[model samples]
Target: MLAGDGKPKHILEVNGLRKTFGGLTAVENLDLRLEYGELRCIIGPNGCGKTTLFNLITGNLKPTAGRVIFEGREITAWPVPEISRLGIYRKFQVPSVFEGLTVYENMRIPYFARMKPSILGRSSVSRNEHQEIMELLERVNLAGQAGELAGNLAHGQKQWLEIGMVLASRPRLMLLDEPTAGMTIAETKITADLVQEISESSNISVMVIEHDLGFVKEVARKITVMYKGSIFREGTYEEIQADKDIHDIYLGRHR
Candidate 1:
């Protein structure tokens, strides 16, 4: 839906979203809107419902209440594959690449999945598809290692490879859960750069859940702080960092 300014409205919207596991509430009454092509970072302490929110949006878990709207369509409770086909893709905290396959081979999986070739016969990539995969690998900085086994890549490289694989699906919204969980300072910075570049260069909207404050500061255009299953604060990095209450809650100084 276009707003008054004639610009596209939120690419993804979560309204009064809630989730519970028996007696425990994981996410509650959370409302979020991600603008088209925006890069937003979500930060909070452990057990703050960060991953649960992702699960709900990606259809890994059905919400106990509320709705998930993507590009003006309500997708709440849709199956995982159905949501993925609707241009919403997510990367979990762990790198889920195909370790047995070469990097190039891993890239081919999503590309072909999107192509949906005939089920009656085997399919092969045409010249244009091959070029597209190579271009995607280049974007993820994995062109040089395309022939290497995915298992042979370093930790950060594996993460990048998984990201590239997600990108191969041509998603409109990318949910990254701790894309830099285990990375050196340098790799984290590179990841920040890559994410920023992707958001700026493409129409994809990125929502990242991260614990690394430094990484968050580097990449977040806007920050959402989650606490005890709800949004505690939303602002620029500096504004969030300056709020003493946010710090206290994040550090467990005041439970």
Candidate 2:
């Protein structure tokens, strides 16, 4: 879709978005956009409203002001499930997976949710559905661990499994909040590669909130820096890194 300005509409747009809790303003007039198939990173010190922005966009929290637009449609204050149905899905900082279920079983849930079969209908997985699950598992590097219980997987493996589960929902836009948290350097690097591959192959627009500079440098095609509940800067990874003001914010040289 094209906007009135004769530009291609962004996959996601947050215009004058704001959120507040009592006297505290968590997000302040934040405007951001994600182009189709773009991989963008949001980086800021703690309390800079990165996660809060995700919350507002995903309908976990209604904004005090402004709009959340997805695919040129206004979705402000839509319920969480409604937003999710509209093709937005998020992975929280902590890995959320079915610990008691096998990795393959965990992958089935989102597919089932998407399919929404009749209660009286056969619940058996179709041959094509089975193939789809396997392909998704392979993409997340968990095909070998399909039969293993999710809780038994390593922390990084669990994270990957959860990501695969999210992907099975066929989201047009994916929000990953600190996806590499608690991962080692090697795991982090692998995640960067996986995210890039997903973006490239699936044509999914991905917005990531990350605190790790290394991960941001590796994965971010573009970066947005937030400070004091608003955008401080937006640029390429190199440009962001070269900015002394951003450095000062990270180093606590400025509030």
The most accurate candidate by lDDT is: 1
The lDDT per prediction is 0.91, 0.91
Give stretches of model 2 more than 4 Å off: 1-8
Mind giving the per-residue lDDT tens digits that candidate 2 earns over 1-255? 587887557999889999999999999989898888899999999998999999999999999999988888899999999999988999998999989999998998887677645642556888987999999999999999999999999999988998998899889899999999999999999999999999999968999899888998888689999998899999999999899999999888985
Alpha-carbon TM-score of each model against the true structure: 0.95, 0.95
Q: Model 1 over residues 1-255: C-alpha lDDT tens digits?
A: 688886559888899999999999999999999998889999999998999999999999999999999988899999999999998998889999989999999998886676545652556767887898899999888999999999999999999999998998898999999999999999999999999999999889999999888898899689999999999999999999899999899779965
Worst 10 residues of 2 by lDDT: 114-123
Model 1, residue 193: displacement in angstroms? 0.2
Error of 1 at 38 (Å): 1.0
